[model samples]
Target: MKKILMVATNVDQIGDQQTGLWLSEFVEPATEWTHAGFEVTGASIKGGKIPIDPNSYSNELPRVWDGVMEPIHDTAKLTDINPDDYDAIFFCGGHGAMLDFPNNNEISALLDHFKQNEKLIGAICHGPAAFVGNKDVNDSSIVKGIKITGYSNEEEQGTGLAEAVPFLLEDELKEAGASYESGGPEAEHVVVDQNFITGQNPQSTHRIAEIFKEHLS
Candidate 1:
């Protein structure tokens, strides 16, 4: 079986502001990939713990899913892993990632390494922001010319977290030189750019995972 690494944030808290990641992000994609016969290993920056937004995990969503759980309610934290061994790297988002993941030198380095090796990279919602930091060995933005999308500015504003998230995702992505474009104002759309797959919001999880599975195959 091909090995795939699943990366989710240890981020459990939403901004003093709003909730994100929504159970759909983890559950649908995880379940889909697991069902697709890929060997998936879930990991976070800190080993042993992972965090899910309390709000998103609630079963009110029409397609509510809750797949990504440790044997515990809390998420797990993983110290390090070999991105090289994995055929693809996936980042699951939550509001917490906006706070913890952006500055993780290790994640940035891993993304750069995976991107350099031309390995497939996956990021959803705020998770995609993590990849926004990757720079090529030449220092040029690796995603500068690529079409991509993530949590959009309008989505942030709608959630009243425009100020809570470190930076506006759509704006920041464009700043990083990505040819950023989102599906619609809603977070339910998915965008795939070759080796890089992105989900606009939690609702996009299922499609994103399906596309990832197709690409991995």
Candidate 2:
């Protein structure tokens, strides 16, 4: 069976309040992957119980909660894993991802490895924050000139967190030379650029996962 390393942010603190994984961003895509016969494993930057966003609670499916919670509580430390073991790496997003995914050495290494090996790599919403630190073999940002989409600046402002996040995801992606695209506010937009796939926001999760599985096949 193909294995997928589904990563969630360990940072639960967003500004003065607490935020963590966006339930749907992680669960929706994960369900798609699991149903498609992939072994999906969750991990975090800190490797422990994953924090969750309270606002994301309403969409939870009780049947899969335990399965989702299992890996969150027993996450593998990034340093302890071999990238060679997985077919893909997916970064699921919440506001928390904006806090930790960028500038994380381990996350960067995982992304670089998967990209180098021609393995699938994907992210949704602010999850694309993980791509900020990844580079190509030429030592340039891997996203340079790549068509991609992520949680947009407009969306951030709409959420009233325009100033709260460390940086604007869309702007940072553009600065990194990514051909940033947006699906115009909460719309489902999934962009596939070779082995890397990115989704615009939570609404695009399942579609992105489905695309990833299609690519694998």
Candidate 3:
């Protein structure tokens, strides 16, 4: 069976606000992948108890708390992961990702391994933060001159945590030399550039999954 490594943030705090992995960001795609018969493993910078963004829950969500609990609660530490064992690495987003994803040695090395091997890599919303400081096998910035997208600055500002995040995602991605693309806020936008896939916001999760499914096939 094919294996996929799904990553989420362990960070639960953003200044005085509580923030972690956004539920729909992880849930929507994860469900799609699993239903398609992929063996998915969850991991984090820290090994256990993946935090959930309190704001992502509602009366309408399918209540997948039990289905995803095992992986989320027993996450593998990013440093302990072996990129070669999986077909892809998918980063799920939230404000927490901004705290630990960028310029992180473990994540950088993991991403580098995937890029060097030409394996599929994907992220949605703030999840693209994991690509920061990563380079391809040729030693050029992985995002340099590549097409990508993520949660925009305006969207972040709309959440009222703009100042809480370490950096503005849109600006940071452009500065990293990515030809960033977007459909603005609240729009579903997914950009697939070779093996690198990124989505613009929560609304884009299903589309990201579709792209990943096509890549896997």
Clashes of each: 12, 0, 0
lDDT of 1: 0.72
Candidate 1 RMSD computed on C-alpha atoms after optimal superposition onto the true structure: 2.9
**What digit string (tens of lDDT, one per residue) describes model 3 on residues 13-115?**
9999999999888878778888789888999988898889989887666865449556887899988898889999999999999988887778878887887
User: Which digits, one per residue and each the tens of the lDDT, describe model 2 over residues 102-153?
Assistant: 8777887887788778898899999999878667557778788889999999
TM-score (C-alpha, index-matched) for candidate 2: 0.94
What TM-score do all the candidates reach, one by one? 0.86, 0.94, 0.94
lDDT of 1 at 89: 83
Cα shift from native, residue 18, model 2 (Å): 1.5
Q: Residues 72-135, candidate 1, lDDT per residue (tens digit)?
A: 2443354457677788888878777776666466777777777878788888888877865657
User: Of the candidates numbered 1 and 2, which has the greater lDDT value?
Assistant: 2
Which parts of model 2 are misplaced by more than 4 Å?
Answer: 59-66
RMSD list, candidates in order: 2.9, 1.6, 1.6
Which candidate number maximizes lDDT? 3
Error of 2 at 54 (Å): 0.7
Candidate 3: give its CA RMSD in angstroms.
1.6
User: Local distance difference test, per candidate?
Assistant: 0.72, 0.85, 0.87
Give candidate 1 misplaced runs (Cα > 4 Å). 14-21, 59-68, 71-79
